[model samples]
Target: MESRSKAHVSWCILLEITVAVLFCSNAQAAPLKITLDTYRNCIDGSILSFSVSCCPGVELDLNVTVVDFIPKRDRLSGHRIRKALQCLTGEELRTYTEKLTRAYELMRALPSSDPRSLHQQELTHCAHGTGSFVQDGLKADSNFTLDIHSSWIFLPWHRMFIYFHERILQKLLDDPTFTLHFWNFDNGLDGRTSSTEGCSEPGHFFPGIYNDNSTSTFEPSRSNRTRVLNVPIDLTFPVMFSEADPAVALRCVNEAVPRNREAMHLAMQKGRVSRDFFGIPFRYGDVRPPMLVGGGSLEYFPHNSLHDWVGGFMRTPLRATGDPVFYPAHANVDRLWDVWMKLGDGRELLQPTDPDWLDAEFLLWDENRVLRRLKVKDVLNIADLGYSYEKVYDASWIFWQNSTGLVSSAMAPTQP
Candidate 1:
């Protein structure tokens, strides 16, 4: 009764908020004109500038100014906007699979020592190894290990990693327009805007595009089959996983839709600042590994869940590259970052402006076969990197920010 009552009230609130905020005056209302440079701050408007002192020193302001989403007109160049593709249908999936296969074939043909070599690149930049932290001309203490996961560098590091990988596939295909597809498990393979459940499975569970071992792009060394027992590899984050009981599984199945939505919600809505959204804040001149800090809600939820579900080799932090799906999975993660950036009435959603974050640098192999150093601030704009994701999703996701657990609690599956 308690659960049902809560659900009933929430449903009413959802309908009211959706009607008022989403529909505005008429049923066919335009997207709220974002008042740029304006912030819809909390009543007790205050923030902690995680700059010189790390994450300390709160300032109460008369108003808040969020990290603004820069308009295209203000950009220097927009020539190479890479579209992150989605495998919504067989034809669409096949197109991406074939292109990815060809790229893999060509990249595998490159000599191992060549920076552009597929294996070499993954190991050097992504996978963990005996000498993972050692880069040319850059030295770290022998005991120091560079783990992008659990560290503040996770976001920017993977951003560059996926960008470079996309470039490799494009160059090898000899098609400047070639781009990678994203395994959008959260939105399902059909990739529609329906707020329905069961889309994450059958439709996307261990996506068929990456599961078939016969394909060059679908590696089999470590995968779903080998996933550790009792592990929630196939589960979406914030939708916690359990086993041994059909009732539990069913309950989980029921909540997947809303929790998945809510996870995206909290990652974007509650995680308003960089320290909150990206992970722990990195301080200026900070050369040590992140101690008490962990990943942000974004990284912990869908991001890590995708990696876990793509288990086997993907389960390992440093060696998941063997699985071809890693790129597409990260592409989806990257897409969400763009999605978060553009969400809200150009008001609530924001990014961090800490000098440590903006100035952070990582390395990657450029398309010219040269080892090039890239900065975190450089890849802020996908167009700047010569890529842009296909505009997907309608305004439905924007409506549920105020939906406080309407689906997760009462929707649990019960035994007959």
Candidate 2:
């Protein structure tokens, strides 16, 4: 009997030791890097199912030096600002809209094969999101697929993607000072716009700049119901309106403002830690399963909700960047990351301090088509990225506390 008990104790110790070794191995994993031969899978297994090659075949200009991303402080015209689209008035609004339209026009005119062209940009998004690319220098039968979504890489990777896109637009315009504008979808409260700090009006509606059919910003494939009926975006999209008819959407629209506030409050309250706010770690050699829900509170909810609401090209990961609204929508997602960092109100919620996360890097083509490598640690500060968002009052949602235990879309309060 004593011998049997001793054997059980030895087995338990061995199991614990094995677990510790596995954890250490994962925690010490290396950062991911991309390569030219990295084949991005083009299979779209979603509702819009299709298969095509998304892999880029362009040969790198090896003669060109690969530059490390250094913030272009000179591009800041007394600090370059990404203003809320709703705030621009008169000449400011007209000029900004015209320039942005012209920039897209120029980008679309580029050859489809050009890495900086609009079509290639769409392909880039597919390569990053659809389990297309894998880690550098891996062998066949390896499962270390490289995707930017559903992990800690989501926020930083998207930020880097847009940064280069803005740069490309600036290059096409020959205007080094041009910056992108963002949609203020989170600020559902009305009177807060009158405040001297952030925006001039409520921005819950889709920005007018993207809706003009004649402009390059317009996308024809999006949902006509929201466009025609003019429904404000439902932040609780996954729960309430993925398949709702227009009547149901309008009914929910009437309650959108309060519900949006509640949704924001809940998303923020849930994001009180690094893993909860940023997402799970995806290190070198990590085999991230496809369609996993590894996104943090903000990424999982509002960021994705807006995408699903936009529908059409914006609906799927494979073709989202084809929609011009995708950029502004993602810009707002990037802005919300900044907002998350400051939500402490003195509590000091922080990002992950792990070296694996801080060291992860990706390759991108700059505005001039120069290849550049960027690291996660380099982009932690927006000011260092040479731009900042207009300050909108988020307090309406920030201070809101959920009283009812309303947890599901079905549980949302409705008025007769």
Candidate 3:
């Protein structure tokens, strides 16, 4: 009897040791480097949205040289003001799977009522609620909705959401540097506006990472979620008001069809000013304009179009976050803002400095799972939050399309 008890104790000890080793091995696993081959599974899993900062990538060496040319915007901007990582390339998306999966898992794991949770009922309310803080007191009424879309809340609210989302992801992954990749859908494989890479258009290419049943990044949706949506990311996908002329889509076969490169040119060139791209910084005047305060060209075209193109579960804004692409897609839009701001030596394009624009408020979950209210002014500089996107025009080779030298799309020069 004593021998039998001793043997059982030994077995239990062995099992515990095995678990410890597995945890250590997984935790200490060298950070995966972003590579073209890497994303074939999760590498290019069409993140279309976000990741953690301080994560591994090919930017280390270049950081040595370019840190000189890159102006030090702020002590903190160094961290938060990340160059929205473009999803056009597969690298960032591949390395980000662990972080992305962990974030989604944890958020979903939380109770639905928690503002951070992504459960259906809560998301449904928020969607109809538009942009709002569903806390006590102010929003006591069940039907009291805060439509934060359009005008000012658009950029600020989204930024706050992305910030909390990124922070939550960082916690789940336990890596502060984890960051999200912005879907640079407009740019092509070569980071040139004119290059024609097969299935490489922003609207085309689906990250095969998510399609594979084995990958954590994959999210099963009715619309062959894993299959790449080979069409161009069409900005003219929606007809807006049923009454509006469908013919506004210049060359599309049908109102619902995707427009060609010409449509992209119009979206960029016509709204060559700040207010046009970002919309009036503050949309809430004395009389609140109806929801959808006439989104700017940026919001109307690339932003909305990408959401529609990544259809199925993500077809509607309410359920958009259900798909991972939503993050990188918004990151791409944010990157465009950076691109636009940097044009003509940074003076040409700039967000509004009005107190209203700066003082905009939005609610998001902090790392502690507590609901935190953040002002639009607080998040303007991502670097303050501890990350920055890869250098815009001169991004590292991690985003290269080929062996020689090629930058990714959506990040191509403003000029043709």
Candidate 4:
């Protein structure tokens, strides 16, 4: 009788554990899938939307080829990994700028109906980012919608977007080796010598390549304050200055470096976890309530703030990508994603394991004007996409010492 009772108790415990596991699995939402029918207008005022479809109607056909991402190692060995350079002054910058401007001039000249055209490229951001889609079975006019921003989707989605955008430029330039460089706006340590040769210097100022009025990279709608020479980009952004007042703006600009360093440190520190860094899960069938604050630390700061700082078209998602400076700006945001994972030796950092996140899919037009489907898991590593960023003085903020002269144990400044 005693043996039988023990057996029954063990069996009951096993059943309970099994049930719990099944329940947890069922609670997770399915992976997101894009369809022509999924498009919608903005459900709230936080992000603007257009009444008309952002995507070109011709590209929405169900019949299209989708090339799955195969590992680069599995492919040909001679393919070069393009290196995206820093925005600082150098011979490299001059060459990159020339190629970039020429490519854009060609891209902009393409008919607006072409998927690779500048207009359509801007619409891609609107379609995916500005509440242009929603969950299945919901009314197009409903108060719930889908946006690539404010969630784990932000990083991977933007990476793929820029990847295709760069590819289009490469096609136009007929140079597969051409790379899309980054605006290193976060590095506020101006005039400091970097430990690595040709790695970086003060890159906080607006990239001059984009400011040249004669180039295709120039956008007149940007803030005039940004054109001021030697005024570093304040990483802390809107919180640091008011453009409305000249005196306060100058004062804030003077104090930008130290404040920027602090902001970068705080953002990285706060984003230690996968959920915190990538943002809350936003899977299929999920209804994003207006109150949901899902943007990760990096996306919220530096990233979004920089968008606002650029002003004009950049301040609005519907028109942000229309500004020529948008691509390089997002390149830095993508670079930081890579940087975030390497922080703390990557022990404490954890990316989402959920299949819903890994398998989330998006549609984009390749350089050939052929529409392709890509998955988040496929772009987890930039190297797989055949690109890498030039090393910069990333340590400036990673080991920053605060006003109190305190440094966290996890990140101690390297001894010179």
Flag clash pairs in model 2: 40-132, 41-132, 198-391
Cα error of candidate 4 at position 139, Å = 5.6
lDDT of 4 by residue, 56-137 (tens): 5444343555555454643223344334344335776677778989998998899886889899888777766655566552
lDDT-better candidate, 1 vs 2 = 2
Could you arrange the candidates by TM-score from highest to lowest?
A: 2, 4, 1, 3
Q: Candidate 1: where are CA atoms >4 Å away?
A: 1-94, 127-131, 134-145, 188-204, 225-255, 283-292, 345-349, 394-416
lDDT per prediction?
0.50, 0.72, 0.44, 0.69
Cand. 3 TM to true fold? 0.59
Index of the highest-TM-score prediction = 2
- The C-alpha stretches of model 3 lying farther than 4 A from their native spots are 1-95, 120-145, 189-204, 213-216, 222-232, 239-261, 270-274, 281-288, 291-293, 345-350, 392-416
The TM-score of candidate 4 is 0.80
On residues 72-110, what C-alpha lDDT tens digit does candidate 2 reach at each position? 542434467888888889999999999999999999999
Q: Which ranges of candidate 4 are over 4 A from the true structure?
A: 1-28, 36-53, 58-63, 66-91, 137-144, 190-194, 239-253, 270-272, 289-292, 345-349, 403-416
TM-score of each: 0.64, 0.85, 0.59, 0.80
Instruction: Work out how many backbone clashes candidate 4 has.
Output: 0
Model 3 over residues 1-416: C-alpha lDDT tens digits? 99999999999999999745422222222211112211111111101122211111122111111111011332212354343333334675556665566677776776654444555323522332232222121333322223444444466566556666666666666776666755545643344454333222333344544445554445566244225344334444442322244532322223222232334444454354455656644322222223444355666665654554455555554456666656666676665655555544443345667655565444344555553545666777655655556543322112333321111122111100
Residue 58 deviation, candidate 2, in Å? 5.6
